[model samples]
Target: MVDFTFNAKEQEIIREIRREGLVLRKYARYYDEHEEELPPDEFPEAKEFAHIDKMAADRGADATSPTAFYMCMLMHRTWGDMMRMKVPFTALGNASVTAAGTDEQKKRWAKTRLSMANTEPGCGSDSKAIETTAELDGDEWVLNGEKIFVTTGIRAEGSVIWATIDKSAGRGGIKAFVVMKGTPGFELVKKEKKMGIRSSDTAAFVLKNCRVPKENLLGMDPTVKKGGGGFKGLMKTFNLTRPGVAAMGIGNIMACQEFVAEEMAKEGVAVDYEAGQHKRSAIQQKMIELEAELEAATLCTLRAGWLADKGKPNNLEASVSKQKGGDISRRGAQLALEILGAMGSTHDQLVEKWFRDARITDIYEGTGEIQRLVIARELLNYTSKDLT
Candidate 1:
């Protein structure tokens, strides 16, 4: 029988994660203000909670199910801070490697920390317009270009960089290459000062004739096919990642909701869900509306993740989740601040920081506009060229 309620084991895991989140919240303000302090990999307080894997193993959870409990844990973690606690071994480039790398390539790069480089000065949402070039030079591939807004570039051991082998072929010629840090010509140009998620490192890099072994070419096929096979293969990584990105936005929205609810309750104003919308106060009605939107966006993200876990195609669903999550987060944050009055705009409270952090969700992992384009293309059964 299908069960929607959490089992005892799942409840225990949730409780533990929430407890860890409370501990992590203590540092959220400090990091937001300092922006230079990196949170330690494992806090002393984290030792009290059972390791997440061990908890799952104890419960004998099905590893292949479409129901992603990990998404819940991520939501809870991000509830404390949008940057969350950075765990090792998981990076954006890891998704690229899993989607496009060969078995040998995966094993070889397993221990290396990797960041993804896709955006350039001229290219943001339109990835096909990337100007980075990768030229074959005998046994080496020479990379030359600049990449901006790399998420973990400051500390990552290597990067999965997108570059075109032939500019005339557009995305068909785009290929991902693994370039380790400390490569002779590769340089970390500068770390960007960001408006939000300040705890996380953002960097810009320059590659001037950066050379790596030909084997470093991801997927091992350098040929530009007629239908953009290379581009599609790389983009498949988004099928899994877009949902996670949406979940992060949902997390931020939930955090803001919880904060507003607590502050309102203190002022003797409460959200009575049983009451009709016409009877409730304006604040109550607004809170209810935000709650409904959050639920809808959360459901979209869960559906997309579930489809991916089931090994089903989820391109349309992923875009839907990203689009909704991004819009909802931005709106939710703005509403939460509006409801709080002038206090919400003050740096003394984390709600203001959340408002700043929430803006990035709609901009990254493909902008909301780009996701809308993808959704429209899918629904109309048209190619990107046919619609855009």
Candidate 2:
């Protein structure tokens, strides 16, 4: 019951995923070079692959739960291209709705492509400093503020914006509002030129007296409690999402590791686990260390997901996973480049692209510094006020 090994059916699915990944790998470089071009929804080879339903139907009755298997698939699938295939059109706001919205709100917005806006010109990781304001106006809530670095803002049907009703109340007054695209005063300011993950659309937004129905307020809670109930509720979504972010990083790192290992093997520099660390060459020892770190980060990520699947609180574990995953990704990419020498920096290879992509892992979804702060406060039994 506690086994981590993939069964026959899961292995089959993974094989299928790998088969498809090979095709997607062909376009990775093209998209990386032409950041404005979007990948096609369906490739020529897409028809040959089994759909999700078919894959599910193929599962053996005695097979272990697919959660861990799926996580592994995520890593393998992304390994080919250093990016997740954007097949499903879900967004971060979808998770927010699932986590905090009322039943009616969930039913209405769950399927909509929704981006999340949290960062502002002045605030990035310090979300509590968000200056966006929301005022209740008879039948609607008028919002006014500028949000920067809104992922998918250009393409999403709407956005889940974090704005405060009472800035004086601190976190307690902060709330999420579902502002649909084409809202009169909500404007797409411009797309951001990012260092990596260029294929993914990142845009800035200007909300000037943008009004949405009062019912659009997430959880439909207007009260700003002293305990910061609204803010806490919104943050609960991150307990699961942080681990997902870590998984993305792990996937990208795994891609770099696999690429390096393959290239090294061709040069007769294969990793030898049978040899002692002292007996192995410097390169071999470094590879072994990197592999160990990768395993540690992977295990931490899986533990966080497992806890969440079991309906257990994973706030601390999620932070741990994110911190480990982000650091590993950044370092792993650098090590990969070092191993490949100047060849790694060439655009002809994916190593450089991965290196650029990995840099964002430590910066987004809360920076590595922020994650450490969370872990420290949790471990020391200190509140945000006590530590920060």
State each model's CA lDDT, in order.
0.86, 0.84
Q: Candidate 1, 230: how far from true, in Å?
A: 0.8
Candidate 1 lands at a TM-score of 0.96
Q: Candidate 1: how many backbone clashes? A: 0
| Model 2 Cα lDDT, one tens digit per residue, 18-82 | 77877877877877888776665465676777474388456787654454555566666767665
lDDT of 1: 0.86
- How well is each residue in 1-388 modelled by candidate 1, as lDDT tens digits? 2233556787777777777777777878887888776666666676676486578556545332434566666677788778876465668888899889999999988888889999999998889999999999999999999999998888788999999999999989999999999999999998888899888888899999999999999999989967899999899988878888888888888999999999999999999999887889999999999999998888788778777777889999999999998999899999999999999999888899999999998998999999999999999999988987
TM-score for each predicted model, relative to the true structure: 0.96, 0.95
Clashing pairs in 1: none
- Candidate 2 regions off by >4 Å? 50-67
- Residue pairs with colliding backbones in model 2 are none
